[model samples]
Target: MGVHYVEGDLTPEAAAKVERLGYTAVWIAGTREPRLTIVERVLAATGALAVATGIVNIWYAEAQAVADTYHRLEAAYPGRFLLGIGAGHRELGTDFRSPYQALVDYLDVLDESGVPKQRRVLAALGPRVLKLAAERSAGAHPFLVTPEYTRRARELVGPDALLAVRLEVVHCGVEAASPNRAPARRH
Candidate 1:
């Protein structure tokens, strides 16, 4: 399991605490990381725990720069970092006219910059991107997903793909795991 934190909320103590809690990985969710300092800090703060960006928005960050940081971090921390890239919500910018295409081009740049396919992941909120994530990268990372949605994602990605889901715990009169809980839809 992994713990998701906002980039700014991260501190060395918080990171160590997560590792102490037995979470194998940490994620900086919804942050536009044109640089990788946060990933490095998380790595520096923990032992035997992986760090991932979930994800760095393709609209704001340059792929080549992202790859450069990825290479540098890997050189220092090795396999403990996973670069999760995605085209964030189209409503965030006018440049997102073709999000899927933009993501493809960004991946091409990362490929040229030597960020290996296995070291990266993609945010998948829908089927097209989910399939692409499974085909071109290591796997799909979908947030706020239900079991039914995850099962369907598995079917779409096939057997050998990674499906790293981001979820939340509610403390109310919880019905989150109800069989009738509606499948979430995010695109």
Candidate 2:
């Protein structure tokens, strides 16, 4: 299983701890620009643990730069790094016009730059984008979604593409109050 941890200034020591804890992968969420150096350090610290960008903002990170970093990391680590790229939200001051087109163009650039479809994922939520992700990249990384939404997404993406959903766990003190509470109580 992969741990979706926002590695904001995460130390190499902590990354090693994650590996020791038996998590197969670590998903690091970035805002504008992804910390490629940090990712490299984390890979260096751990053995056999995959490190993925929960998402690298397409609006801020240059496609060529991202592609170069991907190639370097792949050479250094080999099948240990996954690049998740996304067009950030409009509320975050990013231009939302033609976002789909922008993402397609970005993916095209990555393709030309030698970052293959299997090495990357798209942060997609809507139907159109999800379709694009399935067609162009390895899979879809949908954050803050319900199980029902996931079921539908799976149907849309078909059986071949990977569906990496980010589930949020809210602590409500009482298990009865939480929607996703387990049937069997833990001691």
Candidate 3:
């Protein structure tokens, strides 16, 4: 586990400071910004901290591009980087018919492009998806979740699948942040 939100644009020096703060890993949301460069910068800055793309939107980056960047980072940083990818929200209104199918397709592309399953994880939450993650990728990276959900996710993912939870902690004015608490998710 590590700090929930690692600003993707952090300077190498500041990212190193984050590493020095005892966080085992730093998760940068890659959907909004391409993260391979940031991962490299952070890895260059710190010797031990793992860098993970919290969730690289599958629809945005092609499999070849993802694989190329992944291979480049792995070659440079070894086991210090983990690729977490997802199909993204339906609200974004992508025309894809089925997210699960798209994910499977994306994984197929990733595999064909030479990205090993062990080096990647899926941004999954529900049981079916968690099961798919366990069978296909290294594990699941769940966002906006509670400890109870983490426990359930672990159960659904089985014993071997890595269950990484992305927790957001807001260090702002009390009143300004209290309302940011995530409501309990249903199913």
Candidate 4:
């Protein structure tokens, strides 16, 4: 797994390097829309590296648009694309009522539009959403989680579902100072 910022340009050259380095996938974070063009560019540049949205916000993107993009990308790239979607945080000023139902509705549209179960993942944190992901989509993508959380998530999703977790690592040597002063790292 690798992290790419939505604001950053994941150039074809950079994507090629990621593939050459033996990384299986490139994950983009805070994706509010279905950035199919970016996914296509990465897939075109690399032979096997899968480009996944760390999360496309369910509230912001239209389900039909996402399904259309998924179909197009699937046709062009085959099994090299994974759509990771999420219900964004309520703190972000979104109308966060009944997120579970909203996600269910979104997945329903995708299903209707031909985005298969194995081609998608859900950004699931709680038990409800994690169960939904396991039942409805491919698996669960949980961010900034601990080993215990991962273990619990795996149990919740069951053995068949994919469980991808985002872990953060911090290197602090003798020279390292405060949190802000030290250069933090993530993986």
Candidate 5:
């Protein structure tokens, strides 16, 4: 699990520090900008820290561009950069399509661009998407989900697909009192 945020830009030095501080991975939230640039910078900074896209909205970026980045990063950093793409929220555009179809199309583009299924992951939660993750990509990288969700997702996705779920850790009463209720409400 990792904490993801949208800092405007992160320097290579800062990215290296993040790795040295013991974070297994550094996740960046993707907007409309060239997110691959960020991945490249972070990968150049760290020797071993993994860089993951929290959710690369398929509606926002071209699949060819995403695929190019995936290959570039894999060539430069090997197993250190993982692409996590998703079918964005429905109300965003006229292209607001069915999640399954959108994902399939996005993957088709990725495949056309030569990005291997083993190197990317889907931002999946529900059963249908999880099955797609099993068949199409490396696995599911579900966000803000519960233990029960993980248990059920495992069953739906089968044992082969990787399940990288996000979980919040609370250490004290004061910590637990914060907007923790909001995250819990989503589940």
Candidate 6:
């Protein structure tokens, strides 16, 4: 099975360990991280596993820069890198409008920059975006979704497209049966 880590959370050595322990891919979560170099470090350390960005938020970043990075990584590591793009949620009052159109325009830039469609994925939650992802890019990368959502996404994207889900695991050290544990609250 594959695992995920937020950008800058896993060091290169730790990533190497993850690969050694038989994880297939490393999905990097978070948007527009300042330390894009960390991804390169992880790529350098691992042998053959795929390293994918869970998403790079279009609203917070320029497409050209992202395309440049994609090219550079592809040149260095071949098929090891996959670029995932998304229209992220934010409180940018005026800047966040028309997310669907923004995503389309961003893809235009990536196209002109020659970042192949197969090398990229899209973070889609709804039918329209999922359809766009399948038609224009490699596949869909959905976050925090259920099995039913996966089923729907597959149907929307068709059988040929890829699907990468962001899975965040929270670990609490306190035992469930322990008195120290907080009581469960019900609605």
The TM-scores, one per candidate, come to 0.87, 0.86, 0.82, 0.85, 0.83, 0.86
Over the stretch 99-123, how does candidate 6's per-residue lDDT look in tens digits?
A: 8899999999999999999999999
Top of the candidates by TM-score: 1
User: Candidate 5, which segments miss by more than 4 Å at Cα?
Assistant: 1-3, 7-11, 90-92, 173-187
Off by over 4 Å in 4: 1-9, 90-96, 170-187
Per-residue CA lDDT of candidate 3, range 72-159, in tens?
9988889988899898765665565688888898889888988888989999988878998999999999988888898899889888
Each model's RMSD to truth, in Å? Answer: 4.4, 4.5, 4.6, 3.3, 3.3, 3.6
Per-residue lDDT for 93-112 in model 5, tens only? 66856778989999998888
Candidate 2, 2-77: lDDT as tens digits? 8787758577788899889998988888745544887899999999999988788888888888999999999999
Model 6 CA lDDT for position 91: 59
Clashing pairs in 2: none
Candidate 1 has its poorest 10 consecutive residues by lDDT at: 178-187
Q: Would you list the C-alpha lDDT of every candidate in the order shown?
A: 0.86, 0.86, 0.80, 0.84, 0.79, 0.84
Candidate 1: list runs displaced more than 4 Å: 90-96, 171-187
Those runs of model 3 whose alpha carbons end farther than 4 Å from true positions after fitting are 6-9, 32-35, 90-94, 168-187
Please provide, for model 4 over 60-121, each residue's C-alpha lDDT reduced to its tens digit, 9 standing for 90 to 100. Answer: 77889989888888888899889999887656555656989989999999999989999999
Error (Å) of candidate 2 at residue 183 is 20
Q: List the residue pairs that clash in candidate 1.
A: none
